[model samples]
Target: MADSNDSQPGAPVPCAACRGTGQVISNLGGSPSQVPCPWCEGSGTQIPGHDAQAARRAAAA
Candidate 1:
């Protein structure tokens, strides 16, 4: 059998911070909230936090 959790092409991976839940606790509402992703700039993708090279590549895309 194939190992589970293997990445399928075109499928969005889970968020590491929200544990794929897509929402975090909010102080004002006392409810969940969608936090801007630090990696992909809230695009929900793992983006490099390196130099301007990574940022430029992302912008170009």
Candidate 2:
């Protein structure tokens, strides 16, 4: 039997911060710029210790 915890092994879910784009908008100094997502470290996947619920809420905002 396959593991129940993971629907697809070796296939991680997309990063909530970057929305799988591996980048996010940086508004530093009142200027908008694209930067690698710090949460996933630019891998575009959900990493351990990432708070999915909070990320979703932040994305919604």
Candidate 3:
């Protein structure tokens, strides 16, 4: 296994549901079709410690 420092931690590598391509592939022969990454939600970057209360005041609000 690789170290956390070597690579970003808690970051969504790729939306398994949508794949790293960030699109809902369908009808292979279709002209064009694509969507955002469901896992990362198209952000491509996952915020660390999202579960934690980084902003408790906002959360409480």
lDDT of 1 by residue, 1-61 (tens): 8687787776676656555554444454686666554344455444334243565477669
Lowest summed-lDDT stretch of 10 residues in model 2? 50-59
- State which candidate has the highest TM-score: 2
- Cα distance off (Å), candidate 1, residue 44: 7.5
- Among residues 3 or more apart in sequence or in different chains, the pairs in candidate 1 whose N, CA or C atoms overlap within 3 Å are none
> Candidate 3, residues 1-61: lDDT per residue as tens digits?
7665666655456445555555564354676656554345565544344432434345468
- In model 1, the runs with Cα more than 4 Å from the true position are 1-5, 26-61
In model 2, what is the error at residue 14, expressed in angstroms? 0.3
Model 3 TM-score on a 0 to 1 scale: 0.31
Please tell me which predicted candidate would have the highest lDDT against the true structure: 2
Query: Superposing all C-alpha atoms, what RMSD in Å does each candidate have to the true structure?
Result: 7.9, 7.2, 10.0
lDDT of the candidates, in the order given: 0.54, 0.82, 0.50
